[model samples]
Target: MNNFRFLVDPVFSKRFGIAPFIGPKRFRPPALNINDLPDDLDTILISHNHMDHLDYPSVKQLNKRYGERLTWFCGRGTRQWFLDNHVKNVIELDWWEEYHFSKKEVNIAFCPAQHWSRRTAFDTNKSLWGGFAVWDTTHKFYFAGDTGYTHNISIFRQIGKKYGPFNLSAIPIGVYEPRYMMETQHVSPDEAVQIHIDVQSKKSIGIHWGTWALANEYFMEPPEKLSQAVKNNQLHPSSFIVVKHGEIVDLP
Candidate 1:
């Protein structure tokens, strides 16, 4: 899932002045705005510093409302930003590191992803980038942050061998266009399906598309492409789902 409302100015308005690409206008408003978030929010999981994944205003608002009560978990080299922003109780983990929350009886492990990071030119790859595997007693979930079809896709096999056969997976299936340039950063729909199989997920959901016109494809193209790929591979339709903006799926 992508959330970028609080970053309207920096991401959409190009508050820093446009150099190359600016103003990634969204197709529709977010289903839940920052104010609409639940007060019961206890922990925040940040994948990286990208504006779409980690919004400054949103984090500030959450910290303002929750304070030390909120525990933040993020990738390596990203903790300083939270500290600089006055948010305490931050835990940053390198790939394959795990953290357990006794109170919640859940464990979260940072996993591998073929992706890079950058908020500004000088900060490229200054921080780590990866996905996460979260598990409770009976359920294991994978959140594939943002990835590409790297030759080292064997990383998924490692994930599957360790924490996978995932009960559910949220995989990015969009923002891939002009393959020459994007192939190294984003996964096309076909590649996403491979990730689903690679991770051994019982069910997978397609995300990262239809929210913003981040690539050359139309807003509705990802799901259609995914459907075709699934059919071509003879995979069941229900194996991977494309949910609507405000929809919720009841997991077993």
Candidate 2:
């Protein structure tokens, strides 16, 4: 937003994991390559340490090309991993922590999410996982990193009350199926709509689906359900939506 560019949970590999070819293969190739990104792109926001969300190869490549010119923001305990990879311009934010890029232009805040992290078998939750609330001169945005609808219901309200009525938000709407097992870790389409409401978002773009075959749900099912949920909730169709890969959303 404004003149700054930031990428969140960027996973551009053919597959989702520490190595591109190891995990769930993607149904579609990444929309663009690292080199295709705008020259002004100077920031990255990593919500957590899951291999899928924090692809090692992509991060390494980005840092190699931009070096210190790019600043990285991620949850606590992840800064060391970036430093170990030779990326020094990295900052770790705790829940509700805000980083002032420029008081007048940009401010990035890390907020809690109902999610867990496990890159390796041994380090489950050793690092933090959450979402981000970003504000530019004229717009506010939220990126709801891999999370489920929490039982408390008050979580989203708190987020909204604190830094919400987001001009735009990115909320996950897939990889949920066999509700018995996924409900605790991922939100169903209806739940996602509830989140949009609770967070007081003006508009939300669906994400975390339509790419890799990570769960058993039919890949196209998310948007279908999202549409129904929007109607059930009496929301404008465009209030929360999905964009095809490579499509751009022009916001006022």
Candidate 3:
């Protein structure tokens, strides 16, 4: 299986004149600056329509650079947007459709996430939103886009058991605040740990935190709380890691 490397929390363009920021005040976000990446990038799987995940500017840049050389997989609701933008080579899938690409046996499955979607005021949930499960013949990886704790997690666990024992998972662990309001949309650090256990992944990395200021909590809290939760729950430190921007992990 080819090892996948992710460029975490990158901001390609400033939005609404606000410079994109990562984490609290401590970390620096990475910038690739190029419109095109490697030619071997076969597929780009996006979790949802949120600006961060479905970044239009970045996508446009990539599309212009790579054209049909890259295939995009996104949530069902995002089809029209891509069509409007004239993005070909795009596949929009609902919560459980599987798409395969390449001779390497790479398969992608769209999974459900407990979150609402709206790029504008008139279009909430206009597109289905969710996470993703990617597997090659030998290993599986879960990318938990923005989500809250929900029964669907167990569904993913069942899916994992049926087809997995995933080698790695990228689960969200930030943006939860004022539990009353965020609980239904974002998972807390503790809840993230529970997800790690539910999926029974061999190792899980935390993301989506330390990226944007989407909530009221202090920025540094997510990683700190995640660390404590892992200790309180007795999960191995090596099993869960919080990566910085520009960092790369070679999948085992």
Candidate 4:
């Protein structure tokens, strides 16, 4: 099986730019400028239509550079946005649907997440929003795009029982604030730990923190709180890691 590595979110460089908000350090997202990515990248899986995850400029930049070399897999709601922006090679799927990249031995399936979607006021939930489960011959990876604590976690665990025991999971652990307001959509660090345990993943990496000031918590609170939660739960530190921007950690 081929190895897996995440080139974390790449952001454009500029003051008050969108890059610094998603990752911990203040650096450009990553230099995947279309032409720089591996020729066999084969697929680009997007979690949702959020600015951080579905970056228009970055996607456009990649489209310009790669032409038809890459295929974009996004939510049903995001298809029109991409089409409006002139992005080709796009395949949109609904939750629970599966797409297979036969040549790569990769099977990507859309899964439910408790979240809303909107690019503009008129487009709320216009597109389906959710996370993804990427399974191949050697490994299973779960990318929880953006979500709140919901029964979806239990559903995902059932999915794991049938198709998982994920080798690695990339889950969000930020943007939660003012519990009452954020609780319905964004999960706190403690919730994230529950997700990690529920999914029964061998290793879990945190994301969606230190990026945008989407909530009331201080900039560094997600990781700090996440660490404390892990310790309190007596979970191994290596089981729940917080990666820095532009940093890559290999799955076990």
Best candidate, lDDT: 2
The lDDT of each candidate is 0.78, 0.89, 0.75, 0.76
Residue lDDT tens for model 3, 137-247: 777888878888885446657656755677988888888998999999889999988888877788999887765667889887898989999999898888888887667
> Residue 209 in model 3: shift from native, Å?
1.0
Error of 4 at 128 (Å): 0.7
Residue lDDT tens for model 1, 1-252: 111111111122221112324546567666666566666555677777787777666677677877887688889999998899899889899999999876577788989788888877789999988888888887888888888876654788788889989998988899999788889889999999988888899999998888666688777888999999889888999999899977989786
Using Cα atoms with residue i matched to residue i, what is each candidate's TM-score against the true structure?
Answer: 0.89, 0.97, 0.88, 0.87
Model 1: weakest 10-residue lDDT segment is: 1-10
State the lDDT of candidate 2 residue by residue for 9-56, as single tens digits: 988778866555577888988889999988778689999998779988
lDDT of 4 by residue, 12-125 (tens): 432223453543343234423455576555667777776656776677777777767667888887877878888878889998999887767688888888888877667788
Worst 10 residues of 2 by lDDT: 14-23
The candidate 4 region of ten consecutive residues with least summed lDDT is: 8-17
Following a full C-alpha superposition, what root-mean-square deviation does model 3 have from the true structure?
Answer: 3.3
lDDT of 4 at 4: 37
What residue runs in model 2 are displaced by over 4 Å at the alpha carbon? none
Top candidate by TM-score: 2
lDDT of 4: 0.76
lDDT minimum window of 10 residues, candidate 3: 16-25
Task: Give me candidate 3's TM-score against the actual structure.
Answer: 0.88
> What is the lDDT, from 0 to 100, of the residue 19 in candidate 2?
57
